[model samples]
Target: MQDQGLARRELIAAGLAGAAVALPPVALAQSGARAPDAPRSAPAAVRAHRVEVPMPHGGVAAGHPLAAMAGTRMLLQGGSAADAAVAAMAVMNVVEPWASSAAGNGFATCLDRKAGTVHSLAFTGGAPGLFDPAVDPAELDSGHKAVTVPGAFGGWIALARRFGRLPLSRLLEPAIGYARDGHPLDASIAMFIRRQQAVLARYPTSAAIFLPGGQPPAPRALFRNLPLARTLQGLADAEASALQAGADRDKALMAAHAHFYTGPVAQEMTRFSQANGGWLRMADMAAYAPLWEAPVSTGYRGLDVYCSPLTSRTGLELCEQLNIVEGWDLSSIAAGDPQLAHCLIEAIKVAKADIYRHAGDPRIVTVPVDMLLSKAFAAKRRAIIDLARAIAFPRGADIARAGDPSLLALADDRSRGGDTTSLSVVDADGNAIAVTTTVGGGFGTSVVMGDTGLLCNNGLRIGSTAPYDGHPNRAAPGKRALLGNGPVIVLDKGRLKLVCGTPGGETIGQTQFQFLVNVIDRGMPIQEAIEAPRFALQADPSFYKAGAAISVQMESRFAPAITQGLSAMGHRLEMVSPFAIGSIQGVLVDGSGARMGGSDPRRMGYAVGY
Candidate 1:
């Protein structure tokens, strides 16, 4: 205990207080060794009643600790995993607004222990049936493109009905109270709003809700959103009514759902989108529904990895990159062998080639599944990597390919923003859920809604502008836009090992790949994986733009020898700060009824388990 206290103080003095505070729960026993006057009940023993997991390694859990505590509180209170996740999402909307909101859609994957099955939910907005692609570019970039029907509500309900043990109303209780009673401004939240103060001021309703005093809320100041509270309460009541036996139950739900799409919500949104030259219609909202689909998966060291299949190529590309490296003993590479870096960079490029070519909505592209993952193909692909030089351009292996035909954007676009939030949870019943939600880039086009007190997503602008230019992630209406959010789950011998994901636009997969390697391959703790320096081979469209100058501008930490070696073999080395390469949040459940949670240092997030 004396040593632990001394270490904690050292961390605070070093300004790594968050990391110190988020120490893994399992470590408490070691850290809390007793003193002569100390109580016999150890810290871990006392916490055993709730199994409060801690983030191992180091870092402060960003955001309001209360929100995550409330989620874990629900789990301790006998709520289902889905219920806890929903509670977490609602709380995050208040505490982590730069990352997620009720107005944005979310993706989730869950393992149903009782049913012995895995289910996927795509709470993503779709293109209106009547959307036309020929609209003016400027108009599309402004308001028209940002007006997708928010699909998060439908997504939450779907998961609740299928896997939740508690009623949806119960899940929403904490969020409603916070919205009504008010919350203190958090540092991260205040910083995000202040950064976007000029943009928030553009939307009357957003400004009115978030900046009533014509300024961003100061950290620790009390703030409230009564309208948002009413909306949440109304939804909760409607959910309760739906489960009740009354004609008004159906009517109430219908009204609430309709309000956002074609009813009152639509009326206000339509005015803004139209005024901004957007093409969204009230009908788009009325017709939206979150899709449930089979997840894309691959085996890594016998772990069955599952990911949302359609639209995003993150999962597929990840497998391809891994396949290229699986043939070699990474231990040889990690020993500071220059050849190791060269080979890994080469494998990344090969995998990226496949992403630029065939990864897209399964509805549109025939993803070359078998060929991409074959060991033989991976070996052959690995051969393309030179031991001494980087490949300046991406090249496909001996496999079939496709291209991204949806809307896409380059990083140079002044409109570009890349920030996201991830959340995960599990209940006492052994049900687990992982979710990643975003508004496409930070603050999402910097637009906020009027009546809803919500921030609309600019997800529509995530891909290549030239839809059929052979780019794998071009944007299109009715197509899932090229998303950076990749929520994932890993199972070992049919049991859950890890539930994780990240938010980093093109850097998402790259970060996740390294994090997983650190945990499964290098045996590093989750906190170490998240805080470690990382790198990525930008996907198609991105490399063509950022590739040339990145190596030149990068710092020396990457090693000129490494960059030169990779460049000699065929990689474009882009220097990036080790600041979250991607923000990751997740929970790790061990067999002894012990739960460990971790949040990435790069982003403001928290993981609470009880």
Candidate 2:
């Protein structure tokens, strides 16, 4: 055991030491140069790398360079962390439209330095009021029928109004500019466009914008969306007018909100939906509002981990998984040891079992979130794991009864195409925000509203269409779908420590779980924690098709001995590419107020601090 432990430690040390030298050519190509005619001030350092940027005042980590720079620009402009986050998200909508957009939905967790409290914002859009369960499943999965009311625009304006120091117009300018003047397309987005070419080609407007000349844009090619720019400009103008019209901030915010949900924007959206045989209506748009609530938290060692509550099941499941593993001496186990991986995977399976059965929109389902997160409950669940072998979990009713030992499995359901994006920011004042946003797959529904330049979300596809059978997450009208994105903030002794999250369909929770374990249990630096090879348990059937075994998918970077050990223990293991797992972006704030930012090497992400 000691020898194996030593080998794992040495391997990790070597990997971390070689990270900078091992910079992938693809990442370098994306971040190292600019087009000949591009502006000199445009970002040229947005690639995924292993180095963490340390800053005295603020830090920003985003999925793209231009977006990260937008956040940093806000911080430098005397905006709070919330303000920077809003700015970054708006820019993401413009630059990474394949992953997120102004017409998507999102969830955010913010740590207010002055208030000394953590808050959550749930802006996940729900199924349209007229949604029919009898609709063809294939149609409901894509096309106009899959569209839902978008809440991202309202969510951004709300965050800026409540916690930001800047006006909505100012916060949105960066995105508006990017949309109007054009920005260079990165390698990742270019690939997404190519992959979703057939889907985009079906929607003329979408094809006109994304598939220019009936082809995907080349990497670093200049791309502009004048219609999107005009739409953003209209919002900015309305926001500015609202701010000037009222002495009360709340009333001013209400006016701004009305402009999107109850005014011309709403009319345009509803008209488009109705004209296309979709279900969205003005009532659905006007009835929508982002909810502000307390975050769900669980203590791990001495740190308090907070995550989005309710609509997002990521936080609840993550806390449960952490609690189950907290009883183990994780540090004593070597970094890449099979035993450690087994324990973590087993805990993940247990947490996911409960997540599938109980997680849902709180307004519609009575999810026993508190009970599921209780330490006592975790202890009971942990006792079921056997260190010597892998255990297959029971399905449906057997899961509800914790004592059931029978193992019956169902075929896994393969996850379809959909992408999400994430960003993390920390300002000089110590305020922090972690945001996960998505339009539900690349270019969502491929339906761009006429002249609005808004691509509506296929959020309706997120809900399970299988028989409800009393399941908490069953498909329902006006109910938010179960989402994988969970942004997190960790605090130690009431002081902010880390803000992190990722954009990987079902891999979101698992990635965040491993990140926390890497930082808290293994004592790795933020960048090392993020860049470390990750392992995910493919226990959830939602992402795999029938006949797939409950297996562990790990980065090929692990030591051969570790893989052999897992196989010997009767565990099914599959090796994947080093960058196939998750694109996580994070910021770590130390006791002295210094901030360190890290971006995952899996995708084209950038971390900037100053």
Candidate 3:
């Protein structure tokens, strides 16, 4: 079990490319496809609202400012990028507990400077072995039953044990201090608590910390979680005690891992689950371990794009979407152009359909990862995109019937996981990491894992992928929940170039797609690319719901020309606030090798460097 939790890193890069990108075969066959306003034109760029100081050595970008500070503290202490991320994520557990905690699950894409390669870490938790399919699965939507075996803590230690230069105690110090002392609640986080107060109020353990005094804390109110501090400290003490007894670093980290999964923490969680009529057992927790595997990748415009693989359709879909989009030279397509939006939206629909149909736990279900990532397969799927019109989204099984290979898709994920958190970090050594952690919807299932002070993910809600018996993504015992939250990495000319990710259930992949195009295709600065207006296909995109209600949540910042043009093409648009679509946190390595971090102005996110 300990070996399953540890891992080694490696690197992979693509060859250089010509200035002009080559389109796949059968591209541009749409004679009826409408053309852009100009033959080959791009839009003017704007100055970024905020500027970041370039960091030659290291930098950190996170969903919150203090979390970024926690990372910067580690970087300043000569820690690696992995160390910075561990510290920052621990702080996120304390301050932004409603979004991501030690109990959440997610994926992290890493650029290992030593190996000169990129890899993905899978911390996405799986279904419990005792999950009973005979019961009404809807009951798991937002309660103890919705919780899965949390993989976040497993992932945290996996990274620290392998790549960290400091001890676990040092990495978790800032987070413990914050929880033991106190931190001011951000205005937005306070509003989020108020919104989810009803759910938090249902559980006494959660209510005690989140809804103190029977109400949500006001903005800037001092918030503290002493129990959470003690819990985190206990993990650190486990590692410390092991080292005192002459254990090596890796063994000590294993001791910390054991303390959580097999020791007191696991016992408390199982007891809570049994009392609350949930399914989690000590076996599931003890056997849980994050996996380290090679990332899936594709090449576009001379840059190598990489994504986390199966169990999360995010990366697989990303490769498919990019493969479809790569069929055209996007250099002339500006960010503000309606034609650009049209092409992106269409590509997303195609990729979402295929991934929804085929993606699942590779060890359990049959996922055509190779076929889906192939250029030939993308060419076939690209044929379905009509340049001038929006195909009724979710194109359903008809997409598979239309020559693309697909299995029956009987389920879908409609949870608006806007409460997730994403962060990107880069150390001076060219080591870069992008992490997206979440508890599934806002405030997760609102079930605190007893005195462990952990809020679990509602992955079992809506069956993570679906609750259908024949579906690849259906909920099953010991199966990892298939997700769409993807943290992305971009490499140019075989070198680490950009890392970006965000929080927004289905918008996670779409946001990363638009951001990559902004930087690689249009050459915009990282911050400007992040702050640029974006759109998300909020309506269900699963193959099970073809031709269903389709809604596009677009930021109001888009000019009337883009919105009207999209509306004319059959996309039902819901105009939201300028920053409503996504909160992107990222870091970019410029041609000069300077690293700069960018945090979305949409939220209280910030980047720190020294």
Candidate 4:
């Protein structure tokens, strides 16, 4: 393909020295078989600017500013990465409720630097096990199902208890202070409140807090959560007591768990779920447990990547998608080549073919993980792509064993709303945590718990039903819901290289895929890579108002001629904004060993590294 020296030099410059970044052996061997097609382009350079911060022997925190600042504060206080992440998550619960809340769940993948092991913590909650699936779908959409056994609290506590150097009480102080005394609302929050005021007004509890006097608060209005502060303090007290367990060990731990799900707040949640047709039980709250397991993974250019387990399908799908593409030349595809997009999209389609058919909760479905990520299977999957024609099918070819009924159901999620939030923290000890949390939509279920300062999640409603076929994400009792929030960690040469994740319903996977390609293939910095205009392709029709939402910039360039061409080849298309396509955040270590990072500029995001 090219002189070895030049390739080696480029790899070294890109920080891939002494690394076995094995491309698909076939792709490498076929480099000289034929010249690749040229990429589509606009006359003007599409400016994808990014803000990169550098920290020397310090830390970097990203997502919301208040959350980032809180994490930084923790790091400065000599807390571990886990401590900082727990603090940041708490603040995000208070300030960025549009994205997530303590009432929902989260999954974090952390690296124990000293042990050189990757540990994954899934805080994702499940439906009350004893609940009946035959409950009215409408009621299930209401207040009762809203009360999940909040896994975020337990998950955070577990992380801190396992890896933190600071006391939980100290780690929680920043969020508690913000919630108690109040903090000025940022412009983004204010604007969102004004725009969604009518929608928010539907929920009395939310309307009272988010919209005072039945109107959205003015910009910079002080937002306070006295109840949340009390809840946080109660948790702090519980953690402090539990950490010092003794003769009354079980008693204190039980008290800590009780105060939220089964204590005074329990009545409010129980009443709401019963009225709303939810199936939550006091027993569900007390018995729910967060799972700690090794993350699902695959290698990319010598990097050992880790993602959440199959409780949710994101991790398996991630590996499957990458496996299919590993046999293709990503660099040729990303270096301004339309064929690259076509090929990558095709490969993704093939991987998803298997994902929809088999990927799901391992306890419920028997998935062929080995077959999906195998290089040989990838070659078989890749053979389906035709560079000249789009493979128009209901879904990709099934590369693995198929299950009986499709699990995904098309619930009326338009009402539940979906917005995802994510955070990343790297400590002085080199342990890193990347957590992606969501409430399944903005102000999930639009039903706030009375005076609890908690918004219930409609995670159950995410599953698909009959008319939509037996999709892998259908609603069911005790089944973990499908998620587009894929938090991931990448290790290079046994050292952590990147910790990152993103939001955007189903677009999360496509966004992560493109961002990874931007960095590892196009030679872009982490920020520029993530900020680049992105696109996605899922076999599902739901994501599209009318087919896929293509970028306006791309629309203007392609016109009817290109559309007709792709359409003739079978790709349905719609127009959308480039920025709205997806947003991502991540941290990377440069060849010089400097830790640099970036957040999406299109969002109200800030990345700080000292």
Candidate 5:
């Protein structure tokens, strides 16, 4: 722990105290990539839970401490950032078992430092062929019926095979050890288990693992999922066997992919889905494969922000928000300034409104990607913000329309919850990756796949699609639901500057926008930026919903004055605990060439480096 603290001060010195800028000898110095004349006030003094962890070679930030350690093990053994990311995610599946699972899906944005190229990988799964678009959102099952074809495993293999330097067998070692042996149940996982007890109890496989003694395990109790261990070990064994049979590394990796998707595990998955009246089929498992696509990007000041494209809508939402707010003089606004928050809130609402209206499965629908990202469109959207009062949604009106607030409640009763995890890694050679993975809703359908111990994701969830037939995001056969995973990579003049992401369902892009602004515009170090307060514009009417009641959910840590100012602007506010929102795991490369990592203290996340 002391060593970790030292690593934190090292980056702080390189970025804030000496290399980037010389500060007055006041112990609480703070600085980063802000405009030269901006105030260097108390941002550095704001006592974050932990200092940023710095490593001369590289570092990793993840949702769990052991997960970060697993990634660091790869970096220590001379692996690429992709190798670290894959290894970390494998561990994340074991430790963060509720939010992520072996059968879950996600998106990745990876950078090859040597080529200075960043790419987006969509491992999101498609809705089953028998999917019923007419099913009510509330009636969606918490078990097999809500499942989509599992995509995360195939995606993980693709990343490791294409960009990683280590074997899948070796990467599986850490996770296998933890699962075969046991890791203590921390408060976070225990809390998740408590909330998911009802769903977990419904399935025998889930009940056997998550509900010991017919109840959630106590914190610090040793928990082991030996079945999951064997499942991963089987993949490792499959890879090893293929290697022994004269197969190269790529072929061996694919062999493992086949084992899970086309072999025994896939058969088990399809069998269960078929017997239980679920949507999955044997063909869905066999046809599941990840796609590598072009990332969507938009320039923000001197930085270029890139995000995973649709099927996730992260890029469209994030890019449009940044582009609309790019018209404002945000750099001059103070960190806790209400004007700054208002600009971001307004842009967030507009961006999501546009996204929910037009974004959909690119394979099935022609998304207006070009026009939605146009500067002229952004200008028109920015014109909608009154800058004096919050915009409300009226009956039969869209997000772009101004509405009467007197028509709706001050707070929304519409509550839908989901869970996910994120990780960021940078290898010694400068390669970096940002990834967000999820199992849909909490514990993900809460249905563990037989002896495989692979929990299925409820990817075909409520928000991913709409109730109306003409909705762009309406569920359909073979159409990939909007999985809502947004991983990001930022570049300064084509050089990697930041790798960051979080898991907040619809709030993913919104939280990421604030994190970026905190680092670039506010001159905050990665930790400060991550630890800073954030907000979400909740219940922005989706394509199917006509009325928009503006409810801004914010971390209560903001200054009372700031909250009062936003309330005065006519924005309905709901203050939550600081730890209740998104958990952003980020790594930054400072101007001084120091690599720093910041894991959110909001959850049980941590960072590790050599």
Candidate 6:
């Protein structure tokens, strides 16, 4: 027993020594500045639970530690940013099933370090071909009818074919392992599960997987999803078989795509939906294809900001907000200054008004993209902002006169809840990817596919349910939803500067915009930029029930003086939790080839580097 005790002590000593050695120089210096017996790592965790990792070779920041590590593993295997992103996303689907899933949809921005070009991949879910527009909005918001034709699998295959160096099977191995062997449920996930117990209980399959004993799992409990693992393994096996059958890279990818969208998987999904009275069909699955397009870009100061175009209204909204704020010298404004917050809030209101008025699926509507992105248009909209007073743009005002009021109201009433995940990665070769994914509402209809363990998305809930004639966003066959996802890449002089994104539904664009200002204008580090208190404008009337008043939601961490100042400026103020806004993950790679990764302390996210 004495020998065993001595060995345990030795092991602990060795671990401490290893941790000390692995500490960054800055961390070591800070440790030295404190008392010798004082805990160095403990205080760091208590203060912010994050550090700006300077990755000389590669880095990844994701919503969960396991997901980030999976991406790092891919980078270590000499994979491109695209490969790492796919690996991370797959792991996220298993670990963060409450927020995202393989059955969900997403958007990605990949930056080619060599070519200095940014590409936008739009895998946003679309309505099934036989979608029932007359269904109750409440029904579409949850349950089987809410499921759209998933695009994430096809998206992964496409990204791999375009830029990955490793096989799709290898990229997905980490996620498959985690799902099979089980991972310890973290505090964040545990809390989410507990909160969602009632909702999850409505579906037997979901309850069986998430609540094994009719209760939420405690933190650190081992959680496994063998069915999900098998599903992923089957996909990997299919991809391998296609490659071995003399299929070229693209052909192999297409074969794998066919396996998911046009083969047995599609048949199973169609059968399940039909049995459950859902809307998905074999034709919808076969017709689905993820779109790849050049990212919409606008110059902000000296840096060029790029975002997903068309179906995602966030890009134009972000550009217009930035343009309006560009005329002001935000650098001179203090970080928590109320006037600065007011300006940002007002700018968002103006931008959202334009988004509601015009933004939609480009295939079905003339989005007037150029006009909305124009500096002249921004200036005209900027003139309408009453900085001293809060403004509430009535919902459906522009479309009301153009369409049936009842239909317009139904379409405008659809608002997405903030339930999504994000990741940002930068490889050794300077390639980067920023990705945002969601399953629509949290827990995503709370229904799991029988035996498959796939939690289908309720993405259709975010789409316009009203069948208004000529309305761009009205529910239609094969129409992509108007998503708020805004994965971003920032470039300066044709060189990559930053890759960042967040998952906050309506708050996605606003949070990203604030991050840019904090970093570029305030000269803060990536970690500091994310940790800073933020204000969100709840001015869009469409986001609330009828007669709900517009107000500004501010983090309690902001100075009372600032809140008071905003109140004096005629803005309604509502104090919220310190970390209640968006959880942003990002990486900044500078000209010197130094990459720093940042993860939000608001959630159980982490950043890893080498």
TM-score of each: 0.81, 0.88, 0.89, 0.83, 0.90, 0.89
lDDT of 4 by residue, 138-199 (tens): 65444555445567777776787678777777878988999899998878778877876776
Model 1, total clashes: 38
Higher-TM-score candidate of 4 and 5:
5
lDDT of 2 by residue, 295-327 (tens): 889999989999989778788889999999999
Q: Is candidate 2 or candidate 4 better by lDDT?
A: 2
Model 1 residue 74 CA deviation in Å: 1.9
Q: What are the per-residue Cα lDDT tens digits for candidate 1 across 18-92? A: 232444433333323333224432232110111124533211122346666767767777777777777777877
473, model 6: CA deviation in Å? 1.6
Candidate 6 per-residue lDDT, tens place, 1-610, comes to 1111122223234332223223323322223324334343223222233567777888899999999999999999999888999999999999999888877888899998888789999987688887877777788777888888887887888789898988888999999999999999888888989998998888887898899989999999999988889888888888889899998777877777887888867888888888888888889888888899988889999999999897777898899889989988989987557888888888887787667566667886667788788888777777777867766653422333333234234334535574889999998888899999888778777888766678776766743322344556766777877777889999989888899999887788899988888888877767878888897867433542233356788889898878988898888888999898898999986667567889998888889999
Lowest summed lDDT window (length 10), candidate 1: 42-51
Distance (Å) between predicted and true CA of 307, model 1?
Answer: 1.7
Q: What's the CA RMSD for each of the models?
A: 6.8, 7.9, 11.9, 9.2, 6.6, 6.7
On residues 216-255, what C-alpha lDDT tens digit does candidate 3 reach at each position?
9999999998889999999999999999999999999999
lDDT comparing candidate 1 with the true structure: 0.62
How many clashes does the backbone of model 2 have?
4
Tens digits of per-residue lDDT, candidate 5, 335-424, equal 667999998988887787678666678898777787778888889888878888877532321333222122222222243556889999
Please identify which of the two predictions, 2 or 3, would achieve the higher lDDT against the true structure. Answer: 3
Better candidate by TM-score, 1 or 3: 3
Which lDDT value does model 4 have at 431? 83
Pick the lDDT winner: 5
What TM-score does model 3 achieve against the real structure?
0.89
